[model samples]
Target: MTSMPVESPPKRATLRQRVFRALSGEYFWLYLLLLPSILILIAVILIPMLFAFQMSLGNTSIVVVAGRGSINNQWVGLQNYLSLLQNPSFWQALRETLYFWVVSILIEITVGIGMAALMNQSFFGRRIFRVIVFIPWAIPTVVNAMLWGMIFDGNNFGALNDLLLQWHLIQSPIVWLNPSALFPQIPWLSNALSYLGSNLAMNSIIVGDEWKTLPIVAILVLAGMQTIPHEFYEAARVEGASAWRQFRQITLPLIAPVLTVVLILRTMQLMRAFTLIFTLEQFGLPVLSIQAYQQAFAFGSFGMGSAVSFLIGLIALIIAYFYIKRLYREEL
Candidate 1:
């Protein structure tokens, strides 16, 4: 043993020293790389958000006179929020927003998953089918909105209604944009038939939105499905499992993380669905975002408007926080 002296083991750094080294060592480059994005994020998101929260505490009478500046205001306290609580339109908008997300996303998730699963199978013209599905997702949101507005135009300008009429699907061009058609029969919850009709009318804009965005969901799900190993399916088949059975067991479990990611992304996307809804509201489809904009700009209830915007921001912030937490938890 004396003829072969062994080297001593390296000592472990203390936690505080390790942390100090992390702050000052090669890993400092990670922070350096993150700095620009952090600054940009602060400038674009965090600072603006702080300003909005401060302004939410103030009203136009106090803040507008001084310009949209600073983190101080006349401090309307909780008046804006209290007003929103009592405001019927705000409440209605919020209710509609919730309904839109719940129903539309239900359809989107179900349809998107089924479509992606189908597209993932070894079928003929798979590439063409994928391209077809992806085309709508590729369209600009503004353009998609505009196109839907045109399609749902209450006047004789709608291609969809024209086609329906041409195909003898209906006797006349259905005025889809009519407020009556869009929000008919307020006592819908009283009866199943009325409720179904109300749901159809209420979901007109959602239909257009689904058409525009379902392709994206499909693409995302397909990407997830593609990441699953072929061996897993092969093994399942070797054990005498059918395709559906194998998907139920192996494919679905493996793709759950991706499904969660896609869902979270779509949730955040639709929560602040402003531009499209705004354009659609031009056709009288009133979603929360559009209603908020209308209150702030069109109706000039400056306090109400700010409050509505704050509410929208609050919801989005909560969803994003939860989603990020879920992502981190899943990672762990």
Candidate 2:
């Protein structure tokens, strides 16, 4: 056979060229569609988050100086984290935050489930009742906190105290915000339990937060409840199943998905609860968000504050992970 010139395969594309081609290909429109959102997310979220992380690794002076429009980038590796670990205040804040979050969520879920159930049923003036229930959810959180704070004011003339006094519930007005007054002299309880005093300030804030947010959960659950078929309940009723049994077997399982979603969203929100507590109890209850704010603004310790913030985020992530896992398990 006659000799023929040999040919080499075309050169492989570089990573950049491949990426460019991919972006320029059939998905070009998709990439173009997403470009603005990506840029906005980078500008609004990722950049600030990374910058905050960088600041968390530095000294307080870095943030203080930077706030003044100057740069004094002094790197101090892990010292702030270490100090937070050693800080009693951080632990106390974490403990209180966990307690408050758990208790608040429990109460909110109970109230929300009840309200949602009632709203799901036929009743007189139900539309007006729903509007009233939803009004709190529409109110600004700060305003709700302020309203509750006034209601629970330490003064004898506070709304709740005045009501109680009028009802002959107490001889004198009880200072609901004062720990000492809330607990009095409970010898049986431990110091922490007694000192915390049903966490009056914290619980007051929790109640306010719950009041403002409960309607949201209820509405979501109601939406889910509406999706459930009437046939299932009718069949259960035909089988002579009691109301509680029907709720336990049918309503709960049918609504589990919605409850899970509501739980996760509420968990995340409650974990970072700040505005309500800040306006109502201030730092009287040492929750992590409150501590973070106190550290950043009150004490001007930005590094520590950033550490506290990252820690809170970490806790929220962990909690979300478990809840998400539960969701997955249920779906499976």
Candidate 3:
């Protein structure tokens, strides 16, 4: 009985056993908890997107025959997309969309930053004013559209017209929603303002949209401002920096990230502004979203509609990617 019993090596774990071990690990429960949300995202967003992309690649349409409705889809490669590129209406809509997006974003960002800076200051009823400022944003989009629509109703009964008349601003009620009514002459200016879309109609939409969305930008900027330490301002003040200099140097740089976020979100939202435009002017101002809707429902051209929709999404992604990449680059 000289030697101890020979020791045996541990057996390797089987694949099933390894997998089971992983599933039983600490992070497994976290992944398990996220499963439902992942599944929902796939079902709701990914699946529909895939289907829409497929439809965009084909000549898809709806046909009604003998009291029956059916889909007519045919593989057409990039024909729908190509045709859309060649379409004048598509380009016009794109121009109008870009114009609206640029103008509205500029106004919103400017006014929003100003409002945020004001609100961030210590003042009487500041909290109450903040609440009141957010009320427009909280109002339902449909209701806001209706309210603005009534105000710009192109009739004497319209609130804006009524007010203007009361103030002796105009001798007669103006057709505020009429695209052609405001700037019919002025050869050079007409072309330039055509980007404004239907003159007052587009401008009216911008105003309405600004009223609802400026609050969002202001609130976000205000949050960003709050994150900044008061000591920064104090230090700047010690150096004899004026208010404008303090904002330009200290406030803006610190809040650049928040502004980036606001830009991305507002750009995407503006691109897909359908309900407000539709309610205010119906098919009169054919922005991208309305174009897609008209192509699909009005003309029964599902393929073209899907293409336009996909294009809008693609543009949004591109813009987001640009902003995010620039942000990361600046950070690094």
Q: Which candidate ranks first by TM-score, i.e. highest?
A: 3
Q: Which scores greater on lDDT, model 1 or model 3?
A: 3
Tens digit of lDDT per residue, candidate 1, span 1-332?
Answer: 46787798989889999989987899899988998999999999999777766656667433344456432246788887888788776666676677777777798778999999889889889999889888988899899988988888765558888778778898877767554433335444435432232344356678888998899888888899999888988888889999789878887767778877887787777766877767666625556677767776786555556677788778877876886787667567
**Model 2: per-residue lDDT, tens digit, 113-153?**
88899999999999999999899888987778778878988
* lDDT accuracy of residue 131 in candidate 3: 98
Per-model clash counts, in order, read 0, 0, 1
Better of 2 and 3 by TM-score: 3
| Angstrom error at residue 114, model 3 | 0.6
Candidate 2: residue 5 lDDT (0-100): 86
Q: Candidate 1, after superposition: displacement of residue 96 in Å?
A: 0.8
Q: Could you give the candidate ranking by TM-score, starting with the highest?
A: 3, 2, 1
TM-score, per-candidate, Cα-based: 0.80, 0.87, 0.89
lDDT of each: 0.74, 0.82, 0.90
